[model samples]
Target chain A: MKLDLYKEHAAEYKAVKKPIFVNAAPAQYLAVDGQGEPGGECFEQCVGALYAMAFTIKMTLKAKGQDYAVSKLEALWYPPDGGADFETAPKSEWRWKLMIRTPDFVGKQDLREAVKALQRRGKNANAGQVTLEKLHEGECVQMLHVGPYEQLCETITAMLAFAEANQRRQHGLHHEVYLSDPRRVPPERLKTLLRQPVRKA
Target chain B: MRDRTRHSYEQRILRVLTHIQQHLDGPLELDALAGLACFSPYHFHRVFTGMIGEGLMEHVRRLRLERAAQRLKQSRRAIADIALEAGYGSHEAFTRAFRERFGAAPSAFRRRHAPLPVPDGRAVHYTPDQVIRFSPKRSSRSMSVAIRTIRPQRVAFVRHVGPYDAVGEAWERLMARAAPMGLLGESCQFIGVCYDDPEITPPERIRYDACIAVSGPIRPRRDLGVQVIAGGDYAVTTHFGPYQRLGRTYARLCGPWAARSGRELRAAPSFEVYLNSPEGTEPGDLLTDIYLPLMPAPGTE
Candidate 1:
């Protein structure tokens, strides 16, 4: 059986429940950087383009004797203006990068091939913007936000307070690992793993 | 005492401590311990208490309870099982005893712990390793903190408890055995993995491992265990002063760097890499690198 890294090592994939402190192992990902307001059709298209290329590579590798489950959608958000009020940032000014965890067998060459293959099918996948990369998140404060996307500001504030109490502050881009599919789940019931990378402040 | 007599005494006590730590879940009767110490059963209690600063039974109970509390915080072990593991015969007995020591029920303590202090903090005499640094205006801006990836390492280590100042002894013992194996050199890395926050956990109960990274075939003697230190991205800050003021450097990291960095702490244990030993080096010249584990922020991938 193909090993499920998340299930076998539960701590590495610790769910956002409370403000849990964690250190993450380095993992590979298929990433696409973008600039826009999320929850709009454009962002959804970007997510679709990412998944389309991701699944193409997944299937391509499956045929080569490496079968694995696709990871949940994850995104990094930040303001290009270096502003503190990211919650109320204008949609046009918000910068983001959408990603999915990719296996080691899937490399930069494979990502390029996946993008080309999607184009060959007459679909304009945002394959040009996607890249395969490795990310190492050392220690973090994580929690599950299970409500409307708009309510995330309050939860994030609480998380920031928790980090401040423990002597941590924001360091990298704001990360949200989407655990629930917004299409199937109601906005009020959406579940997202909200994480803020921090350093000793 | 003569050198031979002192050595024997140290060896025998170490043997007893090794046996107790290795088999914490097993019976540690006073008679059996006295036999191991090669002391008369009648006089063992007094001798052990005098030497170790606690009664044998009291020491065993404390160790077991402390181990149980550790498991409760980090693992999903059953309370009844943990109670048994702590050497209590019944749940009620364990509850009463735990409450008496920790000032909370076992479950409550697990949820929001205020750990009980170890009975004796004076295991080894030491010049202090850490002290609160004041007057940040001078040193705060001087610390240069950086984030980078660290590769995984395989190392052999010996655990130590008591004050951070006493951790020097654990390093002493590890090097004693490791040096003969030709494990000390420029190629090898020294790391100290401290698992507890001194501000929270008692100084006497704080856990630390003095480790040396090694590869290839290496024999691990009793009390020396081998494990891998998981390496990844870390926020590293170097302290260029006496070891006592290192906490002030950490405050510089935690208060300024961590609070404003947009990064969060990872679950992995942060560690220190002693760039230079105290020997032949002035206190003002010693360099120690403190590595704090980190992760990306919530809204990032």
Candidate 2:
């Protein structure tokens, strides 16, 4: 039988409107780096490469014998300095690495192999830039934001407040897992996982 | 000479498998599959049956149903819509076929679907103004990998129908028999075939075949069966070290890489080709090449 990770870890993926503190662990990912504000041509290019490479590698492995559910699209957002206020930072200055979590079986070798295949298929110009990376966000804060992506600052603010009340400070980049497909779902109905790594203030 | 013959055979079959997945939403006919493989329709049927362990139509039907089962659980699309997408012209026909395989009506299965159970407040802590809680851990290892094409071979094997984990007995017996025949050597490869989905099928009914590839003739013993395994396109990787790590290796292959690979999967059982004999080699030094057959990548034949 096929396995659905979302269903298997339903409690973990669940997020209410209210901000909550969560502890996360390290995981591997197929990641492509990009600079500047999101929703641009460059960001789309990175996402295109990541998804295409991901699906290709996925099919390759599935053909082998393993069964797994693909994790949602996620990103790590920050400034080059590693500390910048979302409100004060220039939109053009914002940089992020778009990613999809990969299973452990995939190692550097698979990533290297997928790069040439992806390039031959012309999946994305930036497809060659994708590399395997591991991210670990320890004690953190997260919330579910159900609305337009533009308005996510409201939810982020609420999350920051919760983190502040808990005597925690920002420790890592902002992370999000898109639970809704914006291409089909309305902005008001779109669901996104908003997270920020944190530590004791 | 043998390697070249095997490659050509796998190449022909790869095209047919590709055509099946690409045109599943459309009409799949004997002529089409035969054309894809560049074999006459009559010859194609015989070749497909010999290699796949089932008829061509049967394989297509099973694949369609499996794909439909996945969509029914994943999508909010209507049954009628899904049925049409499954190449069924009517809802009644689709439902009957679905019920026979899944043991429940499509809608009922959907209705029975439940998300993960919620954790209680015991794991959560309360603060002065806001509450503190831990989200479920989201961590898995992953790697980059590529697909491989493999050749079919004739093998001597002992068949065991039961739990997959208990197949060591069958291997022991198979080795005992083949070793006496002087078939044990460095070049002799071992393969393990699990013929059922453990997650969906009952364990008692699962079929496990432990096979040893043999180039020479051996008299058929009552305990062993001989057959030709058709070679085709496969995704290959090695599982290193002990058997316990096999689960993690599978998780790595199936979880992240499959989703990223974007290739369609057929109903073929995955087999492990052992490079080193476990009995003669250290557990940490054991190497097994896992071969998974794949349908051809889309947008190409």
Candidate 3:
């Protein structure tokens, strides 16, 4: 049977109408960082390379009878250097870390070997850029935003207000957990979990 | 930094973490781990700190102590033995380190049988079993438990030996085997008897039996087996989430809740009764009643 992380941790991946606090659990991810807009060439290359490595590792583990469902794509968005804020930062100055969660059984050896194999096949030149890292974003305020990406600020504003009323303040990078693929799901129906790590005021 | 250079650094640090996890009981000199990552000890420490957000030795010490904490709670091993296994030279040294990390002495911690100390939020810790990602303990989750008596049940079951996540095949086979034999009745209760705690037992060695309660005559077949569910006084609770997360409810039911409820645990294996099907219900709405057997009265046996 295939292990589904979303199903295993239903509360963590659930979609919520209003902003709510959650203790986001620790997880391992295959991450690639870049500076650009979401759909830029570098971003696309990194996403493709990350998935290539993910599939390679997944297949290898599946052969060993450790199969799992590939989790959703997620990203951490940061403003460019020099004290620029995300709201006003130019699209070119956006720094993002694209990530896909990997199962615990996937080790550094699996990733290193996957890179070597992909390199040998001359597929995904950016394969080596994908690295394994564990992230623990504890005590976050999150809400499900359903619609176009351009309309996210409205949700963020409402979320910020909710947090302020609850005596919490954002303390980490802007994080997004995509539950639906943009290409597959309609923009009106696309579901994205907007998360912001927060701490008591 | 170039992507290649960044990847190299991240990969080396990951390798070091893996090495540390595999050899926590053995010698974990910074020089040895650095050599494994193909770097000088000096450079390796800085790189590891830069990537993992903790000093290398600090990380190792925390992992060793955390592992010791797990052993303290899960087994009856002597503190000295646990200290030795955690790479501490002496019990005193282990206790001091454990106190600093967990804020309580090892014996006191064991006496209380409290949950492990809150992790440092670094996402790097020690696990006795497989190297899985960390999740917050479900001890704080609210639970409504009821003590009730359950009648013994006769059932047909299919045994499964693997990770709990991979029990679908057994269920599929059981359904197929039971459907044609006129055993799929509206009153039949789908049950699962879990024989091992995944946290304590290795994933591959864990045992589970997918069963369906049957009242009529049934014979043991090649693929299916018949058994009696020895039911008695059970502390029952409803788990309102995905079946994959049933372990959390079990942990709560058996851990703090059981320890405080003043009920002695029985030797019988615990089982679950599905309240609803997962076919159409939302994952969050799926419910399962977990029944943990309790010891009978002194003379009732």
Candidate 4:
């Protein structure tokens, strides 16, 4: 996905802190979680579900002629708490949240309505239940990361370390704005901007 | 004073070049061209050479020969007609110019080159060995757009055959035909859709439409008929420039962007919604919105 328009306007996006709403819809999704030797697929089902919900909301906003500024998307997975029967157990869930800012109130309503519609349609093989939430507005530091999605963890680690050294605490949530959709773009060409909303301690 | 004088000279040279390109088929002389530029014959040669990087005779000869080569590959016009249009008093002179430019005579070149494909459903592959070579750099960021499905459109078009230089006359004819029918309303802008091979169609022979898309019933007229333009998801971009450079913009936005994005290119005819026309604005300052139909990548559905 080569978006000439976005690249041309990237500089404008890096300036200032703007008010934004964060919508996190938990669902079944394919994903890998944790780190190192202990890390494995944490909640694949939940990741798939969240992606479907996010995609649905995106489609609904376009249908209403309301365009939103999508700032970021991030997936968090947590393993099941108790030791239980592995085979018969429901898959541990993951939350895929997308942060978007829109000047139009009608556009936000359109997104809420879309989530309701997805919930009404019922969960299937691809999607799960939908949820929406608003993120508090504040200063956030973001850097454009160019390269493959697999190497994104390194960039995220560097950002976190920078925040820690500067005595800035994580304000709310971790998020990623997809500058390039990897499915259409080559792995080496993918661009995803990592953004962390932060506050002074 | 010097800068102002140089600017005027540059403008005159550009105008002369446009005139020569527009009327390459007819006999053209340096005196006549110098008169158009308002320059004295003695200084005109120097000015033309300095501005255009070629002598007056050499530039005219090159343009005419180039035009003849394009016509031979694109149009079914007789070789003699082409030779005459190229300003050769005899077919033999035209043949010599043609051979000099293409390293082959007119008939032999035509035999070796296939007619450039019309902008029909067939996809034309432009390779490195082809006449034009375009290598574009890929952009980093990709835009996320919500796809919208559009309703089908009904249009009546009058196909204008020949170079875009002569397209203005075809458009005038279309406007005249639409005037009596009250089809020339404020809401409508003249739509020109280019189709066919640029390499094959002599600039005079390229196929275009002097057309307008309408919602109501289309009445019968000369060379006018009801045609359905099926609608789908379209990737649109607006370009501001003279109509001549619109093709280059399309090549950049659609040809390279679509190919790199992995999007499926639909066969629908691309359209230009002429927002500003030569009637209301300067030809160099016109604005046009180009639209190309697109679909999701294969296996995505």
* lDDT for each residue of candidate 4 in B9-114, tens digit (9 for 90 to 100): 5456567766766665556666688689875543354445434444556766776666677778878999999998777888888888778767788998898855
By the TM-score metric, which is better: model 1 or model 4? 1
Could you tell me the fnat of model 3?
0.00
lDDT of 4 by residue, A114-200 (tens): 445444433423332334444443555566677886676677677767777777776755656665544345778776666676777
Tens-place lDDT per residue, model 1, A1-201, is 764545654786677657877777787888888777786766767776776676567656654667676677898886567654765667777778899887777777776766665565344446567788788877788888999888888888888899999999888777888876664468887889887878898
TM-score for chain B considered on its own, for each of the candidates: 0.52, 0.51, 0.57, 0.52
Q: Candidate 3, chain A: TM-score?
A: 0.96
Residue B231 lDDT (model 3): 67
Report model 1's TM-score to 2 decimal places.
0.39
| Isolated chain A TM-score, each model | 0.92, 0.90, 0.96, 0.51
Ranking by TM-score: 3, 2, 1, 4
In candidate 1, what are the lDDT values of residues B1-301, reduced to their tens digit? Answer: 2344444544555567667777677877766875897654433443354445545566677667777777777788999999988888999999998888767888998888555444344442111122211111122355578998878788889999888888878976786555434454323568888775454456889889999887655566898889888877788988887888766666556434544455555656778898765542558767889887766435555
lDDT of 4: 0.54
- How much is B40 displaced in model 4, in angstroms? 50
Model 3 over residues A49-135: C-alpha lDDT tens digits?
Answer: 876677667656665667787777899988578987767788888999999988888899988877776665454578889999998
